[model samples]
Target: MVDADQTFVIVGGGLAGARAAETLRAEGFSGRVILIGDERDHPYERPPLSKGYLTGKAERESVFVHEPAWYARSDIELHLGQPVTAVDRSRKTVTLGDGTTIQYDKLLLATGAEPRRLEIPGTELAGVHHLRRLAHADRLQGVLAALGRDNGHLVIAGAGWIGLEVAAAARGYGAEVTVVEPAPTPLHQVVGPELGQVFTDLHARHGVRFHFGARLTGITGQDGMVLAARTDDGEEHPAHAVLAAVGAAPRTALAESAGLALVDREHGGGIAVDASLRTSDPDVYAAGDVAAALHPLFRTRLRVEHWANALNGGPAAARAMLGREVSYDRVPYFFSDQYDLGLEYSGWAPPGSYDQVVLRGDVARREFIAFWLKDRRVLAGMNANVWDVTDTVQALIRSGEPVDPEALADPGTPLDTVLPRA
Candidate 1:
């Protein structure tokens, strides 16, 4: 069933692709593995780009998924700075940017996502930044430090996780931060309206200003440098630098050009894939942010952009490629560390999907577990500054049994005992 004559080609040298290659070898596949990416750096984890790396708490080497030598040691071909320009699904080949075509028995696309730019003018001005790649973080880390030392102002667009984490890092450097968000509060789409305020207050207490319900209309700059950012409400905020954290768009050009079906825009577009990460063509697979996978639990196509998704999904995809019985139904999960607040969220319960937001533990002290419930069933849970309960919470969600609200809120009550048709 297996042969060394087969070659597995993985595009995109991010965490997902690298992990897939690793899993292929770990799964006892001795076939040739080629990993391609546009970035000059080796595969690296992204979370540090917005968190620890920005704060100077993490070293440059820590961001890498594996040492540069590991790829060579593992006998995996690493092609950094060469992006796969096209995919020929019928021919079973991928063309690199340099026009080199490689034949593959299986192809995994982990092209990941690109940061969305501001449509407004003056974005090209100096001091305008984005934080999606290690290269961006390398530059922004110095920019934040410079701004802090000079007592400069940094205005950020969007109050999403990237924007807020950068805001926290800016404040840690003693730089002024003003966040412009289109929503009424921060992280509205992810955590919902109720929990959004929690982040808003958290950042406010740390001296970060927020301009809610506003869009960037224009940016004013001087001498090829950003001076201020203009809001739709006709207000201008001073800025030495501006970071756009609006969002990221999945990189699906290769998949689309190859005639692979993609999820519709309304369903959060990405390369459409089945539970096993197989695209329209069974030989082709997509993972990480570029894949909109059919989740057995959610019973719908869901695309997760978090690091955990890539970390786990890549291995899952590799197993599937090996013709193993695979079901990629991992719970949607992500974590954030902003200032003193560190949180881990599990399961998917975006706004209207849940009936109510219930809290347990101390809210004022910022040590609590919040749950999103529907018909008394736990859909999702987020524990902020509270450790060691994620396993219990995930168990509750998987049980699919109604949980007693009173018992869930009681500190004396153990969470495992509150489930199963309560």
Candidate 2:
């Protein structure tokens, strides 16, 4: 028995909020639903922004999650290009940027995230770029094309996922890429040095230069346009364009003002929530990048900034809001595409969390599965150009069973064969 008079309001029009709204209708909730977004564009998946869309492989309309009429037909109250400036939790209301206030029976925050702006000098230059929004990607696509057509050099700051993907896209347009990172390898904080070198070599072989063990100190420019990227090592990499692919920070201003508990910066900061995605306020919930959720398997708070989290988390939060039994313990998953190599990674194994990494198949051939193990217990697994096996790998981690490294590394031994018997 659901309350037909209730009104549910979702802040943030990203994939998570859209999916949650869809789930509400699908789950037989006939109540009123209102969705607000700061950006005018409809909800869309972000993967293509860095992958296909940036490279001109995907069309502008392909990234959207729904056809335009779907929201109207579904009876969802849609508000676009309006930032929710304040939240009155005690009054059960939210104030938009233009001073419009709306009341809600239940509130969901999926405010998502924004790119971490570069604090270095010359960031205000015309040719410097950051790629977190649709508008940014659109502008960057033209920049890459012009650079490639002119045989210009592009310097990228940071070697994170965004950086590497943009580098690959830029290379496809025939532009020279120089990636500046402070770590010894690309994605050092993520896949760690062992797997980082794989990406390093991948881009290096494709004519992309690497300036590892260095940071972009500043940008040099003539007039209002960028000329080159200056590294902390006292070296300047010539460039017609500079892209700061540092990272993103979760948008949590509304949550903070509402007095919601938040995770610390060092712990991947976001609104702190329990297993059920319930924030400090019972009527207020959060999901996607903004929710620092308590993961049961990992026994730690995780704020995953991947598309899968938003894809799955939204529906889970919706179910919880409906008073249905829910324990969101899905295995963390994400994938990446760079040039000819495609990789799918499952589970968590940040650096220092795993003691050993075992490989199955040939690493040199770019076809293999890398397993991170802690005391023989598999913590995470990544398959590079190796298809399938995600279910098996995730199951092994969920089983919490220690496996023999020899059999885990054997290509002939099927991954599931090593799992504990039912």
Candidate 3:
């Protein structure tokens, strides 16, 4: 049981950290709670950074997870803009960038992740960018507004969710855009080739050019500003601005320094945690993108970078830290918005794990639900422009029962009917 007077220090002031603090209070832990973060701003949702916020559809205040006043009212201390340089597990302390040390009885590492920086030459140029924080989004928005409609060309270096969403936003602002991907298809690893084609076709219809199976060798610049990006095949794509959306790597430096065991690199390199979100060190725990927690459903330790994981994992970790019986076993879920299409995906199945994909609606109309099955068992499901079926899909995945493909693919059959009877 948690001692009533013990102090709980939470590292990383992202959604996970904020939620964990909230959970502590809700659980009646009146102990001192402190949240530290490197960013100057309070915790905020990141998905809108590429979509609504970048496109000017959402305001800056709307993205915040909580207002500054909320922390004060909740009795949680905020240590913004101070990076934690090291964690001294032996002393039960964390040293900040300014050399300030904070002691704690228990700690939560929710350091989240950082964008994988491009190491190619000319990355330091003025027009080259990476979208990870709100500042990056603000800079990109300024660039878009200055260019006017259809006047500027944007070259996106990766075709992942961030790249594609930025492409859609750029197109919305009337900027000519081209996406270059080293893979054969966009989002090939996540949605696979068949469904990936749907996105390629959608972007093509909106006049967004694509160069697949190409590697970016260097970015050519003029007056220290990006002018074009050249591929390994020696083809140069002209651009007013370039965005490298390759992917993000979990922030694990502090955890490593503190001697926390990380998952094998093949499992996506993160602080290894059990179902309760406790690290190998009993006094330390991890959550959000930094924790590779064992999933009861998948029967494997998986590190998910989606918003849902952070949202749910935070409270679960907090409860576990309080010595409460809790398990972070929610099915992984994420969503993306590009152009006019909104996509919701639930469950996890590595690429090539599922033998077949069964579709329930029209792909051409962009309204459908697709299910990936392995030996008739639903492994994952995605809905594009189709609403009110995610819970049903997640239920089917949780049940782990065999589902009939004919009924799964039939548009006439409701999704609820596909599940096993109570």
Candidate 4:
């Protein structure tokens, strides 16, 4: 067995990288752990960037996952503001943008995903923005703060989680918010049309304008600032600022260039891993959004970019590196906070797979729980302001119970009573 004091190099200082380092220390591996990140700041919580932090309700000091002192105290070296340009797999060394090279015994590619940009004419316009990193939020906050003084029109492209949350936040700041989604409803990708309607109604109630099923053609700018956008339908919409939240693709360039086997190239797919999150290369492991793990429950390969997945999978990958193979069974979960509402969802029930849906509360009121049943098995759970249903639905999923549709929709029945104890 190799000595733990040899070396452990982690790329990307996101939640996954930070947690993996912490977990490694806890697992009794005292090694020269080095974390490399392109971002200047230390690892901080990301979910808040679209929620309390964007709304200015949360302070900058509260955003960090741990104080700088924590990493120093734990003996984890942080290489910030330096992007890893290349990896020499033959020699087991990574070269940074500044031409610094470091060798590693065990390498973890925790390189998180990046926000995708629409390839349109006015993409380089001054007012065009994307909300992914802390620097992005800082710039957006500045734009919004300036807009507050004068009623500014904020146009958001793609109505995904970040787009919708930004819409809600901009609206709260009194900016005229418009969300452009190619689909008929927002959240169609995650919750399906039935529940997507629920979200649409919620955003509608908040005075947000929705341009469903409209494709953005190109942005028109004047003097490097955006003025309007042309739609696929040949219609032009005026806008003061534009935000593109279409989606994100994994950052797999480093892994791919180093002769790592990637699942797909067109979509920027990541290193395919087994049950223990070990990549095809035995010495290399991956976790978080960049790693695609085999889903035992879904019986498929999925790369989940959820908060819970990063939190749990990070530690699991580190344990695997320590020669302890532990399979991650935690259901993939994510939460979105939009305009006084909390949306929490667990498990994956890809759209069109479910034949029936069970409603626990009123969707119109924005307080409800939607259970997706595929062949009478609880495949997914979506709740808005009804957080208590998570454990119940998760238990049912774990139990693999063939719950009756009638029992699922019954509000009178206690959720716990319906689910098996333990």
**Candidate 3, TM-score vs. the true structure?**
0.98
Off by over 4 Å in 4: 1-4, 265-268, 420-422
Residue 206 in candidate 2, Cα distance off native in Å: 0.5
Q: TM-scores of all models?
A: 0.98, 0.98, 0.98, 0.96
Per-residue lDDT for 204 in model 2?
95
What tens digits encode model 2's per-residue C-alpha lDDT throughout 1-422? 33559989999999999999999999988988999999999998899999999999989999999998999898989999999999999899999999999999989999999899889999999999999889889999999999999999999999999999999999999999999999999998888888888998899999999998898889989989889889888999999999998989999988999999999989999999999999999999999999999999999999999999999999999998988887899899999999999999999998899999999999998999999999899999999999979999999999888898999999999888989787
Candidate 4 has a TM-score of 0.96
Task: Score residue 223 of candidate 2 by CA lDDT.
Answer: 89
Query: What TM-score does model 2 achieve against the real structure?
Result: 0.98
By TM-score, the better pick of 2 and 4 is 2
Cα RMSD (angstroms) for every candidate in the order listed: 1.5, 1.4, 1.7, 2.0
lDDT of 3 by residue, 1-422 (tens): 33447899999988999999999999999888999999998998889899899999999899999988999998898999999999999999999999999999999999999999888888989999899888899899988765556498899999999999999998888888999999888998898987999999999999899999997888988899889899999899988899999999999999998999998777699999999999999989999999999898889999999999999999999999899987788999999999889999999877979999999899998999999999999999999999999999999999999999999999998889989887
2 against 4, candidate with superior lDDT: 2
lDDT against true structure, model 1 = 0.92
Instruction: Highest lDDT: give the candidate number.
Output: 2
Error of model 4, residue 6, in angstroms? 1.4
| Reference-based lDDT, residue 284, model 4 | 88
Those runs of model 1 whose alpha carbons end farther than 4 Å from true positions after fitting are 1-4
